[model samples]
Target: MSEHQRAMLNHIREVNQHIENLVTDYWKAYSGIDTWQFWLNAVLLIIPLVFLLIYIDRRRVFQILFFGYTIHVLMNYLDITAVLKGLMYHPYSLLPMPQSHLTLDASLIPVAFMLTYQLGYNRRINQYLLAVVIGAVMSFIFGPIVHAIGFLKMYHWMSYWVLFIGDIIEYIIAYWLTSFFFHFYRNDEPTS
Candidate 1:
């Protein structure tokens, strides 16, 4: 690599290391087990998973799990992008990963979407409508509540409406992908 390129790479690495260190410090000071924020984050991460384990449809376990996994992946990507762009951030979290608030990105939101998808599948309800409703609840209600308690903070024109729209879009994408894959899977099954 050229000298300038190497210098830029070094600077980026330094910044990344600094960010990791800051995240660890913040977690230790405010997000550890002694704080209520930590407990809340822990609960947010655990309860939804428990519900999913207990209530997930056994007949369609793989399909439901795949759908939820898609949601988790999409949200993690969005979370990293938003944090990197300074659009939003989690001040406290169960994990020291600077790009995501693990409770919401990996647990609560994905599990919520999974259960919602399961409900729609079982009832043959409209998923688009479910997406919108769930999006609103997560973006407006849960987001604000988390913000109010200092877990999340929005910045740089990132409003609740923006989050609402993003949530709906991601949900639609995940739903479409999951349905498309399972449709083909069903079609390819051997006839009795």
Candidate 2:
């Protein structure tokens, strides 16, 4: 391999290790289960994901999936930092980390929302507006629903608005990032 490749690999490894260390330390004080909860969290996270993949589709699949995955990575990493720093809180975990197994916060539902925006509108402005709408719904509606369930709980100077802010940030980042990739990926073709 080239010198540049080797250096890049080393940098990536360093960054990954840093992330793992951060995640580990952040959950050090939190209660985690070794048996039933592990399976429960894993099942909760994976079930929705499986359903989403089975239902969503086609020429736009990659755009949605790729963007969601990118958002997932960024959201999870940031969430790890945020929780450690007291910016957010959750009451469950699938692993001994800051993220849940189903990763619902970072996956499936948000991706489904993105798919809706992507399919329902062809304009970027429209998508942004839609994201705002969805953010509102999440803050005003879904927030209470999940909070009502033990699946989610809030603490330490946080509110539904904070949840909405996270949604807006996630959607905005995902939209633009996905758009850039889609533009290049579909550049050779013409859209009507």
Candidate 3:
């Protein structure tokens, strides 16, 4: 390999090592079965996920699951970017991983959006309006409560408005993509 390529590889290795160290330290300091924060994180992650699994529309399961998964992936990506940029972070976590807010990213937020999407689909409500309402509640109500409880912390010009706007955009994108894919694939099937 070229010298430049070798140097880049070394730099990548160094960065990975640093990330491993940081995660180790964080886990040691905050994550454990005995910790209240860990239990709280578990509860936050599991309850919504269970409810979604149990109550999601069985007939429309594929559509709702696709939408929810899209939301989860986008939110987690944005959240990881925010953490890397020092915009926000979680101090405690249920699991030892780089993204400390897995409970919120993987479960709570996604499940909430899933249920909202299902409701909007079933009732023929305007999805965009529902997104707005969900975003507002997440920003004004859930955000404050989580912040007050010390589950989330913002820094360096980050605020609840950023979270709200990001969520709204995510919802729109997920809804659009899921609708497109479902319609595209379903169109290929022969109508009886």
**Highest lDDT, which number?**
3
* Candidate 2 RMSD to the correct structure: 7.0
Worst 10 residues of 2 by lDDT: 29-38
Q: For model 1, how does the per-residue alpha-carbon lDDT over 91-130 read when each residue is reduced to its tens digit?
A: 9888776765889988899998999899999999999999
> Which tens-of-lDDT digit does each residue in 1-42 have in candidate 2?
999999999999998788767666544544355445445557
Displacement of residue 180 (Cα, Å) in model 1 is 1.1
RMSDs, each prediction? 1.1, 7.0, 1.5
Worst 10 residues of 1 by lDDT: 93-102
- Residue 14 lDDT, candidate 3, scale 0-100: 97
TM-score (all chains, Cα) for each model: 0.96, 0.67, 0.93
Model 3 TM-score, 2 decimals = 0.93
**What lDDT score belongs to each candidate, Candidate 1 first?**
0.90, 0.67, 0.91
lDDT of 2: 0.67
What's the CA error at residue 8 for candidate 2, in Å? 27
Per-residue alpha-carbon lDDT of model 3 for 27-130, expressed as tens digits? 77767677788899999999998999899999999999999999999998999999999999887787777666789988999999999999999999999999
